[model samples]
Each structure stands twice: as structure tokens, then as C-alpha cells.
Target: MPSLREDGAHLGSAQEPAARRGQLRLAALQEKVMLRFLIKKGTRMGLLILFAFMGFLHASIPDSGADDMEDISRFMENAGRIGRNIEIPENLHKAQGQKEAGKLLEYYQSEAFKRKYEAEIERLKGTVFKDTIDSYYGDSNGAEKDSVKGGTLPGNERIYLFISSSVPIGTLRNYARDLDRLGDPNVFMVLQGFVGGMKRVKPTMDFVRKIITEDADCDIQKNKCSAYKVKVKIDPLLFRKYGITRVPAAVYVPDVRIMDVTLSEGMEGNAKTGDHYVLHGDASLAYMLETLRRPSGRRSIDLLIEALKGGIYHEVNKR
Candidate 1:
């Protein structure tokens, strides 16, 4: 043996290199196994997250059929409410008859209407004898003469009938008949149309003339019946002043103090300087007659007289 110590040292060095190689191989094998285990765990977590997302999406979705039906039901309920709100009255004619009656009662009860009537009466009473004709009729000598002759009576007043050309011919005829039956000569009729256009005037005047002069037996050429004289004029200003918004309305202006004296001692006069009892709509002849007869602090008189008026009736056919 060359040297026992030297031999041992050489063997130890050789064994140390082999041990190092074995340690490197074992470390690489452990790294691969750890990587595989980490990848498998990550994949399982990703799959669980994906399933949870799918469940959330499913829960958020509404049932399309059920939602649509609910929306339809809401719409139908709203429509039914609208239909009930706009329901029509069954008795239209009956409603029409009561329309003015309610209004008249309200007006009678209104303090404002009473104050207005009283104020107007005071103003008019101050100038009762001043010959204050309405400025609507021109202040010419001829107009003044006409006003004195036909426009007014000594203690009587006029009935201003505000009518539109659009009113039915039958309705006009009925009004004329109702007025004729009243037959108060002092109550002059003033037919006023709201329209200002010249084109509309002739037709309206023509209609009024026809209705006034119409008789069963007489032709237009030979018709000699003396009908109630109606002063037909178009005055929008007058209509606005009187607060006449509707057609077929009658404004009955009573003499100052006459209405108050007749109805009650303390009752205010209803007639203003330009104000009148406004009859809003068409009423039956009997209804009008009875209503006129009521002591509403206004002149209650028949407008039509038996004596035939000579001037306009003769000239209507000529026109």
C-alpha cells in the first residue's frame, strides 16, 4: 500500500461529485411534480369560478312571457280608467235643458253678479233722462231719428238676440215664433252676428229675412205678411262688451229701477247700462214664455206686436 491516508482522500473526492449529481436530479424531479400539482389546482378553481358566473347570468334573466303579460295588464288598466273618465251622458237633450237652469241659479246666487248689477244700475240711474243711446248705432241725425222711432220705447227696453249664421234654420224659426207669441211692441229685437267679414253678412241677413217673412201660403214675390222687424247687424265689439261667447243667446235689458221695483224692495236691479239677462241656449217656446214671465228684475214683455212693420218687410223681397 503506497499510503493509506492518500488512498482514503481520493475515494472521498470521487464520492462527493456523484452525490452532487444525485441531489441535482432529485431537485428537478420535485420541481416538475410541484408544477403539475399547481396547474391542476388552478384549473379546478377556474372551472368553479366559470360555473358561478353562469349561475349569476341565469338568475338575472327575467321570464320573457311573464314580463310581457304584466306590461299588457298595466296598459289595459290605464286604458279602462281613461274610458270611464270620458263616458258620454245618456240623455243629451235633457242635459241641454238643464244647462242654463243651473247657470241661471248660480248667477242669481252670485254676489259678483249682484254687485255688478247694482253698480250698473246706479250709473244708469244717474243718466236716465240724458237720451244716452248706445254708441254702436252711429250718432248721425238719421240714426238718432231711427233710435227714437224704433230703437227704444219711453219706459221699455230691447232684447238683444246674439245669433250666429251657423245656428240651424229650424232653431231660428223656433226662436222667431217664440218671440212673436210674446208680441210686446216695446221690446225691439236686435239680431247681432259676431262675424265681421262682408261675405258672411249677406248670407246671415238673407237667412234672417227668410225666417222672418216666411209664411205657408205666400210666395216671396207676393208675400205681404208683416213680420216682426229685426235690426240685423254684425258687431263683434258689442258681443265682447256683453260677454256673449255663444250664439242663440238673448240679452234682455230692462229699464233702470223698473226691475228692482217690480221684484223686491231691496233686490238690486239686474239690468246694467249695457248688461242684460243672458239666455244661453235654445229653449222651448213654452219654456221661454214662462221664464220671461218670471219677475227677475227685468222687463217681462212680448216683443212681437200685432201691427205689421212696414219698412223692412217690403224691402226684403226687393233685396
Candidate 2:
């Protein structure tokens, strides 16, 4: 019923709403796709960051061998400074000996002594000896026995055998006998017992003296005529410094000038430098003798045994 121009105008107006609806739908679909893409990219970025953080953690761990070496070095340095100018306790120096050496031997071999020693060693396990050297010798000068010029014999270096009163008397006897047989007068047997435990001290010294004079006819009163060499000291401080966690340990310095030593992997070159070494546990005479014979290519406990066997004192005296 309308003219052609008017009909065309009405058709254009009717199509406008449909066109707007299509445009709105297309824009909504595009926004959803963009959001999905953004989410995926963010997730990938987060995963990459997590992996990088994990890698950083892995690289920061310490090497076990290096840590052990560091501990050894620290121990050696501390051991070098023990018992400088401290006076020996009177009770320790007093010789409590028996006229009958065989009688003393019987007492040590008795079951009573065996049980006592075993129990004591067990009790001492995991017990850390306090570092009391500073308190004990505070008034004296800061001089150390290891550092003293004439403290040790010239042309005769010394091997210090540390034994706790808790150690079996038989073990002490055997160790002393072996050292005596070695015919090295430079070896010193040290007793690590309570300073004022007179009841314990008396028997310990008696046993030590008996061992010294077992095969020989020596006057205990004069502290002479015995082949065995013994020194009584109550120094938990020294034991701690040397990392002596067990009884019947041995510590020796190949050269007096070397303040410290470490038994590290591939330390053959350093072994020749006259450094200090410690052998822990109750080492048999046979084991010790064999170790002293070969002092190369070993570390930690093995190296210590080897150094002793190699006659570290004798080697140092040669230089």
C-alpha cells in the first residue's frame, strides 16, 4: 500500500536489531577465547617458576667428605693446645703399687674388674666431656705442652696413648706390654680418670704400675726400674679436643712444629708433612704394630693406624 521509497525505509529499520544482536554475540565469543588463552599462559609460567626454584635447592647441599675434613682439621688445631702449664695432681703422681706383681695381675683378671670396666665404658657412651681446660689452668700462662720447646724429648718424639680408667685393665696391660716390646722409650701411657677419685685412682695406678713392673724387678716407691712409661692426667678437655669419643685412643704428632692435621681423601702428600693423627677405639697390639709399618694411602682411622705403624715419632726424629 506504500510507495517504493517508503517500503525500502521500513525494511532497513527492521534489519537493524538483528544486525546488533549478531555483533554482540561475536564479541562475547572472542572474549571467552582470549580468557582461555590467558589462563593457559599463566599456568605455564607458574610451572616454569616452580621448576627453577627446585633446581636452586638441589645445588645448595654440602658435600659430606668436605664436612668431615673440616671437622678433622678443627679437632687437630684444638688438640695442639691442651695441658700447657698445668701441674700434675698429687694424687695422680702418687704410686700405689703392690710388692707381688702376680697378685696385681690376678686382681685385674678377676671378673669384678671386668664387669666394672665394661659398665663404665657403656656409661660413658654418648657422654660429651666438657671443655674445662680454660677453667683448670686459667691462672697459668697460655703455654701448651705440645707447643713447648723442651717439653718433649729432643731426637725422641713421643706417642701419647690415652686410656680411660673405664678401660679394661687387661687391655691396658697388653697395650703397654706391646709398646715395651717395641723398645721405644718415647711412648707415654696417659690415664684419663677422675682427678680426685682416690678410691678409683689408687687401684688404677696400682694396676698401671703392676703392668710396668710385671716382667721386671722394679721398686715402685722410686718410680724407676720399669720399662713402661705412664703419666696420670685428668683432662677431659684434651679428650674432647682430639675427638676421642671412646676409651683407649692414641694421638701422635709426626712433627712437633705441625699444629694440626687432617686425614682427608688423597692426603698422601700431606701425610708426609708431620701432621698430627688420632686412632680411636681399643686397638690391638698386633693391629697397631702393623699399622705403624705402613703410613701411606689411608684416611681417618685407617690413616691414624698407618701413621702409628709407620713409626711417626721415629720418622720425625730423623728430620
Candidate 3:
């Protein structure tokens, strides 16, 4: 009876504190939700920026010059490997029997390698020789023995042949076709092992000599093709300049130009301390063909410059 109203007022005041606590809890929960949302948005934004940068970087790369050089190098390496592995001659020894024979068969049957090899070799024999040989191979600027005749390249382009006398009949037949196709007057060939290997039959030598000397001009309609015997002695200076330390090396000289390394470039020479096996006619005629036909802007004298520089050095890639 003394405080019924007072009691009611105290109850109302108690309810106020409880209400305040509820409001505070609600505020904290809202803040947590907002923070989580912000973090998720930030993560998405960062990912978007990373992807944009990657896309921009992916759209820029060139197509010529250095890339072409790299392609050329790869091409040469592939050709050399293929030629070395296949095209077996009579002297090729497969003493390991079935194992070696199977390996040889695998290589021989690889159409991809064979096609590439054939194309490159044919190109060397055709284009490079056609472009340069007539100027230097003959006694007097590509003249025939009886007439003071000038020469022209077959196909009216560069024609060069990188061949070993020991090549198989199939390879020779393929080569013959290419020679037949040249229609220019100045085509020429560099006989890689012309002077030093085991001698061939007189008939074979006479036939090859005659083909290169007379038939090349008659069949191809040009006096440009010619052949020269690569000398036997491995000139140390020349070998050093070209970095050709391997034996049985051949260097095609169209206009006397070589395309390998040069002495001034600090290139090492082709000499082994105690072995003479590398000094004979076992020269890499195919590589020499590739070297002689190397692309150049200069004329005949450029060949001499290349030869002096040691054009045989880069014939094959490093083992």
C-alpha cells in the first residue's frame, strides 16, 4: 500500500537495461557480416586484376629474324642427325646384328626425317650451287675444256650438291633427278671426299666425273655445274678457323666462300692430339653442302672470306 506506483516505476527501469543489451548484440552481429562481405569483395577484385595482367602479357611475340635463325639451326641439326643415321653405304658396319639392324630400320623408315633431309639436301645441291659455282670452279671462270664457255645455274637459282662418292645408289638417283631439274648455267657441286677415301672403280669415277663435268650442263641446259676434289691435308689454320675438329670433313666452296667460323673469332681448330682418323676424306659432305649454300648478301669474294674465316666450323651442332 505504501508504494504500488514506486514498484511499477522500478520494473520499467529494469526493462530499459535489458533492452540496451539487446541493441548492442544486434550491432556487433551486423558489423561481423559487413566485414566478411568486404573481405570477399577484396579477394575477387585481386583475382580480377591478376587475370587482366596475364592476358596482356600473353598477346606479344614476334615472327621473323632471330626466330628464323633458330629455325634454321634446328633444321640443320635435324638434317645432320637424319643423314648420319640413315642412307647406309656398303662399308657401314652393323656388327651388333639384330639390335643394330632394327635401329637402322627404324631410322630408315622414318618418313618425317627422310623428307626433311631430302628437301634440305636437294635445296643445297640445287639453289646454292646454281647461284655461285660458275665463278670459281673452272680454270677460267667456269669455261668448258674446249670452249671459252660461261656457266649458268640450273633452275636459274643457286644449285649445290653435297655428296660423298660412297653414297648409295638410291641417294645418287635422287640427286640425279635434282641435277636434271636445274635449268641454269652456273650450277656447281663440291665433292666432299673427292681426294682421299678408298678409291672407287675407274668406271664409277669416270662416270661421276663425266656427269658433273659434261652431263650437268647438257641435261640441265647450263654450263654452270662443276665439281672439285676437296684436298686431303687438314689445314690446321683452316680447321681452327672453322672449328671443324672432326675428320672426313668436306666444305663446299661456291665462289670459294665458306660459311662456318672464322679464325679471328677465336674458334678452335680440327685436330686431335694422337688421331689421324679425322684427317682423311671422311669429311661431312652433306654438312659442307649446307655450309656452302648458306645465305649471304655478298658475291663470289664472300666465299673466300667465309673460307678464310673457317666455314666448316658450324656444319654440325655440338654433340
RMSD in Å for model 2: 26.8
Better of 1 and 3 by lDDT: 1
| Residue pairs with backbone atoms closer than 3 Å in model 1 (clashes) | 182-302, 183-304, 184-302, 184-303
Which ten contiguous residues of candidate 3 have the minimum total lDDT? 270-279
lDDT of 1 by residue, 268-287 (tens): 34334544566777764445
Q: Residue-wise lDDT of candidate 2 within 1-319, one digit each (tens)?
A: 3223422222233446897757755766677788899999999999999999998888787667888999999888777666564567767533554445556546544678556644543432213111221221121222233223332233224456778657776787777655544434335565544434533644554554555544545564543343343333444444654566777877655543323222211123422334556666777855653454356322333533443455546646789
lDDT of 2: 0.50
Q: Residue 198 error for model 2, in Å?
A: 6.3
In TM-score terms, which candidate is top? 1
Tens-digit lDDT track of model 3 for 1-319: 2222421222233446887757755766677788899999999999999999988777664546798899999999999999888865665455567677677446534676446534543444455446433322222321322121222321122233334445553444434433333222223333433234323223434445443442344433334554432111112343444344443343322332222222111123321121111112332333333444454332542433344234334323332
The number of residue pairs in model 2 that clash at the backbone is 5
- TM-score list, all predictions: 0.39, 0.34, 0.22
Candidate 3 structure, TM-score to reference: 0.22
TM-score of model 1 (CA atoms): 0.39
Report the poorest 10 consecutive residues by lDDT, candidate 2: 128-137
